[model samples]
Target chain A: MLKLMQNEWMKLWHKKGTWIMVGILVILTAGMMGLMKWISLQNMGGEMTREGMIQDPSSLGGTVLLLTVIVAAGIVASEFSQGTIKMLLTRPVKRWKILVSKFLTVNLFGMFLMLIGYVVYLLLAMLLFKSDAGESLSSWSVWSKSLYMLLLSFGNVFITSTFAFAIGSVFRSSSLAIGLSLFIYFTGSTISALLSQYEIAKYLFFTHMDLTQFETGMMLVPDLTMPFSLAVLAVYIVVFLLISFSTFIKRDVTA
Target chain B: MKPVVELKNLSKTIRSKKIIDNLNLSLYPGQITGFLGPNGAGKTTTIRMMVGLMKQTEGDIVIEGVSLRDNFEEGLSKVGVIVENPEMYKFMSGYKNLLHFARMHKGVTKERIDDVVRQVGMQNRIHEKVGTYSLGMRQRLGLAQALLHRPKFLILDEPTNGLDPAGIREFRQYLRKIAETEGVSVFVSSHMLSEIELMCDRIAIIQNGKLIDIREMSEARESFYYIEATPAEKAKQLLTDGGFTVEPFTDGLLVNAEQHQIPDLVESFIAEGLQVFAVQPHRKTLEDEFLEMTGGGQIAEAYAK
Candidate 1:
């Protein structure tokens, strides 16, 4: 299993697309951070501070969601597209092992992106601006919020990759997988808002996607809780994996 | 010779339509076997099932005494394969690609990677990215990857697809060398019959999902000579009278006689007042036999599409 994961990791790194995705992540994060800092510096409504710049919402969601969708969508769909899936599947490994490794690779890559992006943006914010958020930027609340944002980014990546991975596996079209994943990411909040009247909307995976919202005690549904949302996300993960692996095991590589 | 791989009554059905029907075939060690079939004859389907890329509707593919159906890991570990185009991560160097594939197999050292790289003659550009490679170069890199693990069985589908004649000749030699030196049983599927004639020891042909024939490439061919003599009708009569079957061709009489018998026929032609221009041996090419077997449907054209 470790070997399979290693192979998957190697393949991902070898792809120009993976590096391109990372570039997009870093550049966009820096760009978004810079813009937000400029807005804060204007000091029209809120205090402008270096520590304040690190707390932008784009760390977890927004444009980063597109990168996650792409990374996720390309995980399995590009294998089929590029015909490297045959090379992978022909090896002495279970289909599930390969699938799991790719799943692991995408998430690990996402985590890496999150951690590095956070640290770099943190450093850049400290270097570029002066802060008055607390006695120091390392205050417990700021650190806690940064950690919360980390969890939220990971949460978003986990859901987006699995959903997109499932779509890629079943549909075998990266464009379609990415297109639909991004569509859902962009519109899900509005859709969930419209559907919020229904009691069942609270259990929807998208309703809990913005994990940072839960940290602020702003539950989209009154009954929504972190534990309940985690449990729901867990179920959705199982469903996505079940669909991806089952289809992969059964489908013929005639093409 | 022990069978390195065996397909026992393998069948595949799609939507109630039988695509591959009860196919039974076997491959032995230290030999190259060609899988030949016309378009939609289940060649790719059977190959897919052999490598576990597709599920067989029935039966088993046994490799190195392991069942592909019952024990996939054991069966597949004994084999290395390249199906359709030689697809690799184009962004990676040829050596890195081989290294990645080597990770899938146990005990595949860096020595083996370099050895296979040298074997495929990709040393100069092993560090160059695959996207910069031509089709032939990529095919060589693909072969290098397949050989990296020193698998007991090697399967190549349309391996010579984009190679030129020189490339094809070199690739064929490498396959033969691998089979002889490593004792690997190689199964190759190709529409290039002339290539199969030179490269494979035996050929298993299929049409409409049924194994039509398994031909030995080393089979003794019919001895035929084209008598290029003038006044050929008179000479043909003399040969027929002398108890030899003589058939008139476009430019000469085709005599069903061996080389040792050529001198006597030449003498007879001289005796019949015919000018003996030349006698040319009529070599029966594999293309003629393949056309005869498959009813003139060009198999290569199917894949060319």
Candidate 2:
């Protein structure tokens, strides 16, 4: 299994699109920080501080999610499109092992991108913004809060990319996976809000997708706890993974 | 000799239609077997099942005495496959592509990879991207990757689909050498009857999802002598009375006779006042036998004579 993941990682980096993705992620993170600095300099908004921006890393989450979704969707679907799936599936390794390795590789790439994006966001925030409330950069309280926000933001990226991966593997089309995943990410919260008064809203995965809502005390559905939301998201992730693995292992691989 | 691979009562059905019937076949070491059939006669489907690309609805495939259903990885570890046009990671170099596959099989070292690369004569271009390779080069790389683990059984589908004459000849010699020196069993499916005739020791014909015939190439075929004589009428009558089932061919009569009896028969025809213009042996080609076996089925570009 470790060998298989090594193989997957090698193939992933060999593509030009992967490097392009990393470049785009860095540029976008910098651009977002620069735009915020410009907004503050124009006296058009309240004072922006490094600590304040560090605690709200959700701005980078959308970019990480998009990049992760692209990788996840293509990791399986591109094999079929490139007609390389035959060579891949005909090896001595079992089908489930191959699928698992690809899944793990996709998440690894997502994490790597997230780390890069956060570092860029941090450096730019410190360089371009001041400490409005005189908050120390090396303080433990600020670091933990920043890290916690990053973790919550990653949760949203993880769930969305898994959904895309499942769709891509089951349908064997990256475009559909990316399109459907982005659609759900953009509209899931609004749909949950529309049905917030109903009991079914609590059971919906969209209601729990953004775990950061618990930190901000902005509950989409009333009386939802962090543990309850985690439980619901766990079930959704398991279902998505089950669908991906079963379909991948049982596929005919005519390509 | 014990067989290296066996297919027992294998069957597949898709959408209420049987794509492959209950089929059985066995492949032995040090032998090269040819698989022949018309399009959609389940040639690709059977190959897919053997390699685990498709599941069989019934029966089991046993390789190296291990059932694929019971344990697929162990059974397939000894097998190597190059399904039609081995699609590789075009972005990576040929060496990396080989390394990628090497990681999938156990005990395939880096030295083994270099050895296979040299074996396929791709040492010069091994470091180049696969996207820059020609079809022949890609075919050689395909063979290189398949042989990286030194498999005991090698399965190739249309192995010579895209190659020059020299490349085809070289590839054929390579397959023959492995089968002989390493005692590897080979299964090749091709639409080119002539290629199969030259490369295979035995041929298996299938039609309508069923195995129709399996024959050894070394088996003696019936000898035929074409005699063209004028006063063709008297010649025909003489051969008809000579206890031979004579069939009328172009400008002559085809007599099913042995080699030693030919001179006497010519002499008898001369005495009957018939002029023997042409008397020579006619060996039946594999194409004729294939057409005859498949009931003149629609062969894809096989009748390009």
Candidate 3:
């Protein structure tokens, strides 16, 4: 199983599209950071304090989470579209191992992409918005929050990637997976907001995926706990992965 | 001889349509068995089941005496398969693809990978991305992947489906070599009759998910002969009258007879004032046997139409 995982890693590395998606994440994240920094500089007036003018690095987590979702969707969808899953499954390894390998690779890619995004965010914030009247460097508490947000961002990415993987396993079409993923990611908050009036809507996977908000110490519903949301997200991950693996093992690879 | 692979009443149905009926087949080791069938004749499905790629709706497949459904992973480990187009990561080089598969199998070393690359004659181009390879090279790469683990049994569906003449010949030679030297039980499904005739030691004819016939090529070819004459109908009648079953052809009549009876047959034709333009022995090509066993072109046309 470990060997199979290693093979999956090699396959992920060899795939050109995986790298292309990563490049896109870096470019988009860096581009957004650079643009935000420039905009903040332009708004700086005579009375503007260094603290007000400096771009908050914590906001970088939001952009990283968004990029992670997009990258995860692409990685899961492209394998099915390219028909590489056939080769992977025909090996001597177990079916579940194949799915687990793919899941691990996608999560690893998500983490790598997030790291790249954070680095780019730091670079852009430092180069474009550095202050002569330096504000105190971010406190340990702020860094801890940022780290927690990053971890939560990964969990969010894993949940979304697993969902996409399940859909892609069933549909085996990249376009459909991409369309569904985008719909869920972009329209999820609006749908959640509308459903907030109802009791059951809060329990949806989309509602709990926003781990960033939890890390920022904000809760739309003060009664809802962070541990409860995390637990629900964990359940979703396990169920999605189980379904994906089971379907892949049993489904015929006629394509 | 102990069979390397056996299917007992194996069947598959998709969406209430039975693709493979109660199919029974046994493939022995050290023999190249050609699975001959037309398109959509459940050849691919049967091969898929043998390799554990697809499950059977009814019955079971036993690989090396182990039930495929019961111990799928173990059964699969003993078998190497290439179903239809051997799809690989197009962006990855051939060497990388082999290496990746090699890692999945226990005891597969760098040397073994190199050996397979050399065996497939892909050593020179193995480092190039598979997308850049020609159809023949890709087929070779697929073959290399199948052979990477040195499986006791190898299952290939339409192994030469898209190859050119030269590629087909190369594949046939390689398969023959593997079957003879390594003693691997090779089950290859193909539509090309002549290729199978030359390549397989035994041939299994399948029609509409049924195992119609499984016979040694020599034994099957021995009972049939193609004889050319001016009037094929008369020649067929004469052979039939002489206690031999005959099938009329466009240019001649194919006679089912023994080698010793050929001279007498020609003499009888000459005595009857019917010119025997050609009296050569006719071997039943895979195509001829497939057509005969499947009830000719009408069944194929009905399916197609």
Candidate closest to the true structure, highest TM-score: 2
Model-by-model lDDT, in order?
0.83, 0.93, 0.75
RMSD of 2: 2.3
Enumerate residue pairs that collide in model 2: none
Each candidate's TM vs. the true structure?
A: 0.89, 0.97, 0.88
- What is the per-residue lDDT of model 3 for residues B1-305, given as tens digits with 9 covering 90 to 100? 99988889998999999999999888888899988877777888887777656778999988888887787678778888887788888878888888888887778899999998888887899999999998888889989999888898998888897899988888888888888898899998887778888898888888777888888876634566788886766777788889987767667777778888888989988888887777776655567657877777555588888
The deviation in Å at residue A203 for candidate 1 is 4.2
What TM-score does each model's chain B reach against the true chain B? 0.88, 0.96, 0.86
Per-prediction interface RMSD? 1.2, 0.6, 1.7
Q: How far in Å is the alpha carbon of B10 misplaced in model 3? A: 1.6
Model 2 alpha-carbon miss at residue B239, Å: 2.0
List the candidate numbers ranked by lDDT, top first.
2, 1, 3
The best candidate by lDDT is 2
Q: Which stretches of candidate 2 lie over 4 Å from their true place?
A: B230-234, B299-305
Residue ranges of candidate 1 with Cα displaced over 4 Å: A48-59, A127-141, B227-255, B258-280, B298-305
lDDT of 2 at A44: 87
